[model samples]
Target: MQSAEGTTAEHTAAKGRPTPKRREAENRRRGPVAPPPRTQREAIKRMRGNKQSKEERRKAAAERRERMMAGDDRYLMPRDRGPVRAHVRDIVDSRRHLMGLFMPLVLIVFATTLVQNIVVQQYATLATLVLLLTMLFEGFVLGRVVNRRVRAKYPDAKDRPLSIGWYAFTRAMQIRKLRVPRPRVTPRDAAKVG
Candidate 1:
């Protein structure tokens, strides 16, 4: 039918070709650009690709752990990596840390508390507290010394992480055998490094 503007309904509905059915047009827009899976097997095959990628990631992580344990350094945590941190580790490892005695002393004190003698338990508890305070003081001193040495060695490097001192102190507190990236220097070798 003709309208006042001299346009017909057919002309309006037919731009280049007949207007597609609304449902068919919508479906076309929503359809996958990639070819649809032809069968359940194809869908499963695509899903299995994710498992393979995950397996690859797991293997990579295991290899990284192995490298870290072997002292490759590249895979070491940020707190443990870098030349200055390594030097700090060496210095702490070289000396006998009073903090290292804290654990054994604590165990002894704990054992004492298990005894029947109340007097002995009191003394043991007191001694344990005192020992802990002393160790804390010593750790502070150790951290300061480590920070000084690191600053001296790397005066120009100002981007050191804030935890460097704490990292050094903690490593110093650990028994030599338990320290990861196992101490490269002995007490005798420490003097030579300095």
Candidate 2:
């Protein structure tokens, strides 16, 4: 206990610096290195000083949008964040589903009904009903298949079947060219289907 040569009598490395307090360590982690503000006005000025320039923010937003369109996880919406949803999207994109024509078929039916001929309108209505039934049937089958495959791949996935199943169904119904996070695989490149 009587050491005098700048050495501690204790059995320790003795770097001679006391540990930093938790609050100080947290502040350092938060990236603010200035001394504590002596007044409220200084604190307000510091807050405003931390903000980025408008150009910097715009560039950052554009970059984030690009990443989102490319299906980068960090920028994806909450509903699209997980690998399970990505797998579901890929599966839907890789296949040719009849429901993918639903939008075009609807337009065709609408156009046909604009004609004055009763027979043409009747036929258009009939065809529309038939297409709806077919789309529903195809969507049901696609949902089941995709859900099974997703379960096979991500067995421990926390996603519920209805959530991802509907996601697959809705994705399958969209026009391939218009799907967001554009198809990673073409119809011929479905290597991940297993």
How would you encode candidate 1's per-residue C-alpha lDDT over 16-58 as one tens digit per residue? Answer: 6777899889989998676878999998998798789999999
Which ten contiguous residues of candidate 1 have the minimum total lDDT?
156-165
- Once fitted onto the true fold, the runs of candidate 2 whose alpha carbons sit more than 4 angstroms away are 1-58
lDDT of each: 0.81, 0.87
Best lDDT among the predictions, by candidate number: 2
**Quality of model 1 by C-alpha lDDT:** 0.81
Model 1 stretches astray by more than 4 angstroms: 1-63, 159-162
lDDT of 1 at 194: 52
